[model samples]
Target: MEKKKISIDKSACIGCGCCAGTYPEDIAIGADGLAESVTGVAEEDVASVCPVGAISVEE
Candidate 1:
């Protein structure tokens, strides 16, 4: 298995917090009101849940 990385585009984030809600362990809402990837493997569910297309996974 390979490690996965999640990255959020702050400019594209809409502060909806949906990504955080979808993956609490891997994402969080920062003080800037944007969803941030904290830790854990990046899943498709998280990217799919982002309303603003801000989340992406790195293989």
Candidate 2:
């Protein structure tokens, strides 16, 4: 399997919870109130759901 890197630009995150709501297994809201890739579950869909374009994936 190909390894992927998930990056979250907290600055751009609107804290909308869309990522966490859509993929609770992959992402979550952190103490700073930003979306974080907690589990590194490798779900690219999370990036698509981000309203502020905060998530990026590199494969």
Candidate 3:
């Protein structure tokens, strides 16, 4: 199987919780009040849901 990489740019993240709400298994809010990649991989569409364009999925 192919591997996927999920990245969250803290500077761009607004901590909106949109990603977490959409994919709780793959994302979460960190202690710093920023979005974080929980599984190191997530649905590619996750990038599109971020209002701040903070998330990215790379294959």
Candidate 4:
């Protein structure tokens, strides 16, 4: 299976903590108050909790 890459559209991010809570190991709240990935973590749980749809998984 192809490795999925996670992407966050900062402009579309509403500063929600859902992604951060869901994927603490990879997702975090950046200084800009947006959801950011520490690395290219592919987590379906994080994407599912994103309300503004700022998270995307590329495979």
Candidate 5:
């Protein structure tokens, strides 16, 4: 199976740090105060972490 990549919608993000707090290994807070994919990959089910649905997993 192919690995899924995590995508962060900057416009939709509120910089709540929920995703980063939950998945510190794969997600982080960027300089812009928005959620960013650390390795452009998803090691866990993190799409549901965002309260605004800013995080998404892509195949």
Candidate 6:
């Protein structure tokens, strides 16, 4: 089985938190106000909802 992972590009993130709102279980805004992956498989959803294209997935 593959382990799913998600990451955010801090530089590209606009801190919209849309990814967080879309997938609260897996994404959230860090102290710096950047989108962060908390847990579970959120890569695909984050990448799709992020308007700035700041999210990426590692399988």
Model 6 clash pairs?
Answer: none
Ranking by lDDT: 3, 5, 4, 2, 6, 1
Q: Write the per-residue lDDT of candidate 5 for residues 1-59, one digit (tens) a residue.
A: 34478788999999999989987877889999998888888754677778999988875
Model 3 compared with the native: what TM-score? 0.87
Clashes of each: 0, 0, 0, 0, 0, 0
RMSD of each: 2.5, 2.4, 2.2, 2.3, 2.3, 2.9
- Tens-digit lDDT track for model 2 on 1-59? 33256888988998999988887877889998888887765565556788889898875
Tens-digit lDDT string for candidate 6 (1-59): 23357778889999998989978878889999897777846745457788988888775
lDDT of each: 0.77, 0.79, 0.87, 0.81, 0.83, 0.78
Q: By descending TM-score, how would the candidates be arranged?
A: 3, 4, 5, 2, 1, 6
Q: What is the lDDT of residue 11 in candidate 1?
A: 96
Can you write out model 1's per-residue Cα lDDT over 1-59, one digit (the tens) per residue? 34367778899999998878877877889998887778856675567787778777765
- TM-score of model 6 (CA atoms): 0.78
- State the displacement of the C-alpha of residue 45, model 2, in Å, after optimal TM-score superposition: 2.4
- Model 4 pairs whose backbones collide: none
Tens digits of per-residue lDDT, candidate 3, 1-59, equal 33368899999999999999998988999999888888999877788899988987786
| Runs with alpha carbons beyond 4 Å of true place in candidate 4 | 1-3
Which candidate should be chosen as best, given TM-score against the real structure? Answer: 3
Candidate 2 residue pairs in backbone clash: none
Cα lDDT of candidate 2 equals: 0.79
Candidate 2, residue 39: Cα displacement in angstroms equals 1.8
Error of 4 at 12 (Å): 0.4
TM-score of 2: 0.81
Model 6 poorest ten-residue lDDT run: 37-46
lDDT of 2 at 3: 28
